[model samples]
Target chain A: MNSEIRRLTTTERRQEHCDVLVIGGGTAGSMAALTAAQNGADVLLVDKAHVRHSGALAMGMDGVNNAVIPGKATPEEYVREITIANDGIVDQRTLMQTARRGFGMIQRLESYGVKFERDEHDEYAVRQVHRRGSYVLPMPEGRDVKKVLYRALRLAKVRSTNRVMVVRLLKDGNRAAGVVGFDSRSGNLVTISAKAVILATGAAGRLGLPASGYLYGTYENPTNSGDGHSLAYHAGAELTGLECFQINPLIKDYNGPACAYVAGPFGAYTVNSEGNRFVDCDYWSGQMMAEVAEEVASGRGPVYLRLSHLPSDTISTIEGILHTTERPTRGTFHANRGHDYRTRDVEMHISEIGFCSGHSSSGVWVNEKAATTVPGLYAAGDLACVPHNYMIGAFVYGELAALSAIEHGRSSSIVDPDESQVEAAIDAIYPPLSNPDGLPQPQVEYKLRRFVNDYVAPPKSATKMEIALEHFERTKTEIARLGARSPHELMRCAEVSVIRDCAEMATRASLFRTESRWGLYHQRSDFPDRDNARWFCHSILRKDSAGAMEMSTRPVAPYVVPVEGFEFPTTAAGDGEPDAA
Target chain B: MPSVLSRTEVPVSIDADLCVTGCRLCVDMCPLDSLAIDPETSKAYMYVDECWYCGPCAARCPVGAVSVNMPLLLR
Candidate 1:
């Protein structure tokens, strides 16, 4: 099937070739591009927005949550902690890579001018955020992380293109041949052929509607409309753990991160509405989330972070970090509502549900080397399946993907696909431009996400998910009729399809598991209990060879370090192969 | 059905005088693709209220033309 000697022709299209193509310019995308270029590969890094400030780190992070710095934490300790945090549903091999390589990734960032908080000894002032380990390294100056990464991208000589929104991949049989996309600025179709493609687009963060009724305001950057997640799924890659939704405790209405990790260092922890510490620890886990969900839904309604008791100086320090990085608009959001951390407590609520591995494990499945099941296509960062792999994990895996892609690009004999295949994608993007009077992408997106909140957002019931599948099924047709008036809206229209696919996967994975796990994330109201007998395996969703959504259970690979106190499915002990559920 | 002309309280404010023609850095940098240059005036403006208030448009503008405010829903 490597027969591609035909002359390619196209209209209103730009064609380019690179040894490796990194399809996003966010944290992982930039790092992957930098590594590929440093290894002396001709790389193309294209993003829907500018590389300088895009993806989840558009304004940079509040801190590195998974920094396994020496003298602070060991890789084994981190693996064990994450194994426990994920409720024992982790592929330790992939997470072990992130844990082991994260320190180097942090130093690389530091060398490029991204600073991390240090103690008097200038040792990485790692603090305890997880229940069992100290891995949260605060970067009070973390928003500049994007600037440092952008500089690294420039120094490494990666050719960067901003404002290009990729819609789909051009597959040459099983391997990814190239991409089919358009420029966001002028709405022109641009195609790129490459030996290897790495999708570093962040999570499907916009899957659920925010309670505030504002669609753009979300916990993760709204730009991460699950473009990479859906792109991989449609390209026939197995997506894992989507049932484990990325639910965060956030400041209500504003829908920004409450930033418990940032606030915890300064004596702020989550409390019930009556201002009592309901949970023993502030580290985010399914158990912690379950506590918050139960407490919030209880007579102790509207759980919050009680920071009013902190001294004024301490409160100001917390405010400084909270206001300037990782959803920096929290200051303005609180001010307009007449709330103060020194006086009134910050109201906290569970955020909109999403499919992300950054907070929880749910993404396109990749191995320890960051290779997806599809040949020549790799994934990194939150969109890849490395459980609870925070910022450092994203960077490490990004480098891994770039290194692996460079190696693959050297050996792969793939070439450009036929022009008709490229033209078909180009031809598809134009229909919305032609159908100016069709449904607005926003209206369709809003409705789809609302359906997610209603049926798929957990404390899930079988009936609700079944109804959700019905709505998602109808959304598949409604998304086709989505119209756009501008290139920007066209980008959104294209993203709507990705969001729809993620919604379907989320629903299917949620339904197939049939057991309540991850607190309110995948808690089936009807099931009400963890069924370790049959549902302990990772929920893997894939589009079958016949182009139908199929859900199966992938055996959670046996841990390198023996895990205690948690029960594994009986099937995992005897059978290593996945059981079709 | 007919569409009604509507306007929103845009969170991002760009100085038309400082927004030099061909300087669409803010327009290009907006992650949501919320900001676009007015073709006739050649100055970038927030065409939609979909701004997440992540503030990259203001950060990357070479001419310091973009000023961002938190949207009213949150602000």
Candidate 2:
């Protein structure tokens, strides 16, 4: 962790060069850097925080959500399940890449001393939590995931820097030429000129205001801030599936995941106040979210994950696993309220809306090679458009992006860094530092996110979204006035801009679809029906030449292995009775 | 614009005795940079209210110099 933090210059600013630059060193960026380095490209992996402990996988994950081990589950089955889970909005090629290469990634991580649960015969312990295939591979000791990746990065000789928060990409014509950002600790400016760039900056988790009213309280790591999503949009890269919001069933106020995946296989499940299951599956899909939201909104006002039914020993196991990985502080949050699994029910509420393809499909669009619409630019992990491609999928897509960049850079010459563009980027990052009495970032962000909640948080409406767009446009002006007394505050100010971009993208994409899909994720109250014949295409958004967001659609590529009888939870009870509309 | 320091106790705490003089392991690894080295004491301290309580500071502290409590608001 200490070794990952280094400074290149003593003065105010510095410049560096690399064949490939991987931004945001988390689960995916680490792999991208390693793959690029192993492929003989000089790579620079820069992160806003320490690479050893940053992004969604910073504290490490509890399990691999989509692991396709050879005998446990085949690639075909894995792809089909994800396609169905996402309601067929996915591009099969990239998802197939994740399914096929998932085992290799697991083996690679295992070689690095990262352990996954194994059966008595030494096979991967894959659990069934999704609608179809058995994919969840538990990692009880997975807190060491980042440590393993850090060691791998060092072994592969990937050059790196930390605490430098990249604000935007330096464009060479329409292609990404480099990156520019400021150090979050010292405010020292940074510029990295590269032949190609890979964005693993993670989800737009902070786009929606949490019910808790705390700005940092979000389902994803707070540092994500939609950096990749904003960067890609501004660089003119087309982003797809923005309408498919990532809404999870979380602990009411704390807002962390209720973690049905870890508890479901152990016999605990999500239930309304009546202590009856509403949805047939525990998979965190928009359909499941819709059902839960419906039940909670009705007379079954509150929800709880019923864990008291389990045996004492089984409860102990659940407690041990839930308390240690990912959101490790959940135990304390529970104990503070005197809620124990043995006697009391842990309260459940749906998570605030955000963009995350690792859970649902809303992110920067990319192909099977992990390349975005813009050449020399790539995306992976939750920010990439591979639906339901969780942790292992992040690693695979990272490898795909790195290899793609290496191949592309080896053939093409590095774009000459534009001096004016570099100056403009540096100029954009310093306004907060220059002001002494401007509006504080948190207030600005809080107001911005409140608009997101009112306008975009599910059960959507055309009139309300139009109103959301108006508020977002006004917030963009407020973001310019955002000031900071410290580098940390400046990071928030920069993040506000990113959040604004995501909010606009989400609203426009939601309105463009004109019909509800993915259940609560894109539930348009006005357009209350799924129009597969007309609205089946992926909703795409990007910044046009005139600097306005343009919304369009891209056809979902033909399924490689034909999909049939796929289902997302509908507006019906588990007993197949027609639920209240 | 003028600014006033708002007071709030951060959840993460660093044990001064266990921390080494030139070491900023916990400080560097904090995603929020909420943990910092006190220049005079040369020991890490929770300097800001931005901590997410993600626990990397405590987890990566080689000598186990850091510990985190749930934030005041959440608790």
Candidate 3:
């Protein structure tokens, strides 16, 4: 109940310099900052919240989704599976980097006190969640992930500024020079100059409104409102697979992961209202989601995770792991509704659409070295276009980005940011503050996201997407009228702008790839078919010099691992048999 | 135009008797920046209803006085 609103007349300005600048303190940014600092580089890590607990892994993850073990799976096998999973719209070299370097990254993470599930024989207890490979490794007690990363950062002597929301990147002749943002705790403008910059801000989770009509309730952390996507696009970086939205099967009203990945290894599977299994694979891919969506739309209107038949001990074990890990409030949420996994079926629903290259293939494009098209600028984790990167992929690519940044810092000199660009960033950020009596930030964001759900969510058509683009254009003016009562409100206002940018990107990308591909994701009502001859390659988009989003295509690079006449499977279900742990 | 003030129960609650006067563990760790120290009592309370209910506030509490419930809508 903060009723008082203050109109500030002037704001303080601060400046700093560093060898490497890491934008986010999430899974990838933390590793990037840690690795860069450990390699004897002066690093500055900035976050909108405290680095100790922020981003997607703020409460820690239940398991690593794409772990590649030496004996269990080889790099080439992993690459082929990901290529097929992403429907051959992948940069095989980038996936190979994570496939080859992930085990070492896992060992490095273990050195930093992160625990992994290993068997009595001291082998990684990897489970099969993919169609062809076994990669899902559970971290049953992995709740202190951020705390451990924060401690490692402290030991490395890396400088960090918490509660600062970065909104733009500073470029020195097509190379990333630094970043510009403002402190959320105090309304001071912050400008930091660096020789190399890495963008690790998490996915655009807040693009579509949740079914519960709640703004903060999103599958990804609500704090990650597509800031990195917007920042990279504004910096003139090429983004790929934006049409491949991140839509998962989550709990209905709670909007959390229904968590088949965790329960699947424990013998739980998704079934239709008739108590019959619909999809054979519980692995999260666009094809799996399409099958689930079809089942929900058919005679079997609602889907439920059938755990009622499992033994009592098995139920308790699944509950223990699910309750303590990511989205721990899930237990209380189910209890409040008088639903128990032992008796009643846990309800499942499709999640709101989002832009996550970690789960799908939509993000700022990066190479095997984790470098973006812009020099001195790098990206990794959920925001980078390494399809289905998951947590371990984020870790592996974070290390790669850090190694590249360290090498870049050794060769490059700090370039001075133009004062005019810094002033423009300041000018864009403070408009909401001056309009203290105008529209509230939350209302503006809610309406924009609602439009995303109406016009840009699945079953996309060119007509509806063009309408969405029109609404997003008008939303730009609506965002300008947002009012901020405090620095916290100002931060929310900035996120509204970022979310708007992501919505526009999603629409434009969906409209550009005039075909039904990636299953439920980017399924155009008009196109209705996947045209491999034309729309087979990666759909890339970026902000052109004219300040407009321009679309183009790049032929999928010569496949490092041969995939012969690959046509993405419309449905991955087979025999309806669940995989055992 | 006058700003309207409405009351709603927030997720994160701190017991004033058990909360340390100068401690800000919960306030500092909130990802959404929802919690703040009440100037009148020097006790931390959720100032906004925008809580993600991710439980960092409850986990980071030094005195074990903070508890986070699901936001009302989700609950």
Candidate 4:
């Protein structure tokens, strides 16, 4: 037993203790930390990057949609919108809870000096607003939200360690005790003991070529490495909704800027590859891509825009309508708007329509109060599965996670730290740091990315997924042999571990359902129908004692909404004509 | 007729703050000898009449603070 044990006495090791340890300092993590600290708990926020630019902070247009609008909007209306958007797959109870809490979160954020944009009418003039309950708040430009949140955390005296990637949660029996991670700057192992752990890490982008295009270049922040989901699963937390992945149709190739084309104010037509217009102009009235997806799936076309030649003023007006910064120059706009022609060269065009799960919906399942099955553990942001539609819902979920964590921390009694849990965490990571093997880190990442992108991408088939699963099992074995040259490299290894774990969960969930539902990126051709009877419940994945991935199913909680006198316009339409200029 | 000699001319100038020492290679390379090194600042100062915004000075400035803006009418 003594001979089998390998420990590094020479390497630097540091330990810290806190009431709450929040991982991944993106929107959700930062907000959770801020909320927890403000409620008078000592919190430590950890992130993989030195900067806190996660997906929501980097790519979000700064729109916060909450059910706070006056007049006709109510929490019920917001819940209905989500259920309608999700095709009745969303958990209405969770959706309503999030909607009810959304406005208060925004108001709290405003109190922190995070200014939202307002209209000339002196009311918030955000793009998406529901009459009774749903309203959108604008985010400031170029990562200001992250900076503001960081400042707020600093003011609240919340401690943070950036550039440290959390590899896994340290568990004492079924309860979370702390987390084990590596410092990117020094390549040192740092462990933190905490009373409660909140996984606020943002969404996972399946490992692949960075999504780039003619109009936008490497737009999505590369940091969404899926560490939170992987850690939670490894720590024996139940994960749900891995099958539902949202894809944004408007992403441009070549890493150009993302134009707000989808947010076009009503009546816009999406054109296909043959330069022909498709999609029912009225269906999913606000979000045109839902109809666009149907058109593409039916083989009607790969869409593009077609419009009559426009004068200079008309071109500018169209650019304004599309919320594009640059005017539609003959060369730039034509190339930017034309995705159908570009997607043919998969290698050249980095941007593909609906390539990713649109939102970070698949994660550790938590109660309505954001508590996981595991005691002393909580999740928020894209990391926690709180049933709602994609991006719009994630913002509200982040706030809910933070608020729920505050409540959980306050009501719960403090327990002494478990030495065995700390020892176990230390033992698990010490091997990688001490291993002398010189392994290339990027190769591991490339292998993981290829495995997910090639095998698990949308429009999946059972045979293809099975083949991919075989490769994934092989890759999991290969990952153990991977060597890290430095601390940052060690974090990369941890990231690979997280991604592999997430892929395993995603694959198992995709396979278990045997049916295609919303965001069917991993669709199996064998069972094409939406099997509501057999697979209505959520697929849950957990890790066993031997560190093996396990899978199961759990029933989704039911909730009913009062949907009466919901006045939706029937003939209301905007100009559907594409600008030809 | 007894000819009066016709000469083609250009103009050039530079800012000291935009220039640094151990540079000014552009002053020696100008074919028309329109540039001169300011000994105090070790930057290239140009004679406007003989200088032109030909981009050689801006390209050669290692610090990249030098710029040449030409009028649209001149082009």
lDDT string, candidate 4, B1-75, tens digits? 132334433334466786776675665433223466777767777642322232345555677665443311222
Clashing pairs in 1: none
Per-residue lDDT tens digits of candidate 4, residues A1-581? Answer: 12212222124666777888888776667777777887787888887753333344532243454435545266777777665555454456667767676666656667776666666876765555332233555543312455567678788888888667777687755677788776665656677777778887766654443432111112234456677777777777777777665344442332322332223332233456655655443222213444555655556655544333334455445444333211112123234444221232111112322112224246677766677778788877666776443343554555566666666656554455465665665554544555547445556666666666676666667776688778888876667667655554565566676667667666677777787666444356678776666665566677767877676665544446744332222432322211121
TM-score of each: 0.95, 0.94, 0.95, 0.73
In candidate 4, stretches whose alpha carbon ends up further than 4 angstroms from where it belongs are A1-11, A51-55, A65-68, A126-143, A208-220, A254-263, A266-269, A274-276, A281-301, A305-360, A388-396, A410-437, A545-547, A562-581, B1-75
RMSD of each: 3.6, 6.1, 5.7, 14.3
The lDDT leader among the candidates is 3
lDDT of 2 by residue, A88-139 (tens): 8878888999989989998888898999999899888899988887888999
Candidate 1 Cα misplacement greater than 4 A, ranges: A1-9, A573-581, B15-23, B39-42, B60-65
Error of 2 at A130 (Å): 1.3
Q: Measured against the native two-chain assembly using Cα atoms, what DockQ does each of the candidate structures obtain, in the order listed? A: 0.68, 0.67, 0.76, 0.02
Per-residue accuracy of model 3 over A394-497 as CA lDDT, tens digit each:
98888899999989888788877788888778777877776779788877988999999999998999889889999999998898778887788999999999
Give the interface RMSD of candidate 2. 1.6
Question: Which of candidates 3 and 4 reaches a greater lDDT?
Answer: 3
- Predicted model with the maximum DockQ: 3
Choose the strongest candidate by TM-score.
3
- For every model in order, what is the number of clashing pairs? 0, 3, 0, 40
Question: Between 3 and 4, whose DockQ is larger?
Answer: 3
Model 1 chain A: worst 10 consecutive residues (lDDT sum):
A1-10
Candidate 1 local lDDT, A1-581, one digit each (tens): 01111111234567888999998898899999999998899999998878888888888888888889888788998999988888888888888998889988888888899999889987999989888889988897988888888887887778998888887787877888788888876766688899999999998988998887678888888888898887787788888999999988888777676768888878888888777889887877777888888898999988888889999999999999998888767787787678889898888888898988988999998889999888899999999989899788888989999999998887785577567776666555666666678788878889999999999998888899899989988987887777677777778888788788888889888889888887777888889988877876888788898988898886778887677866565666533333322
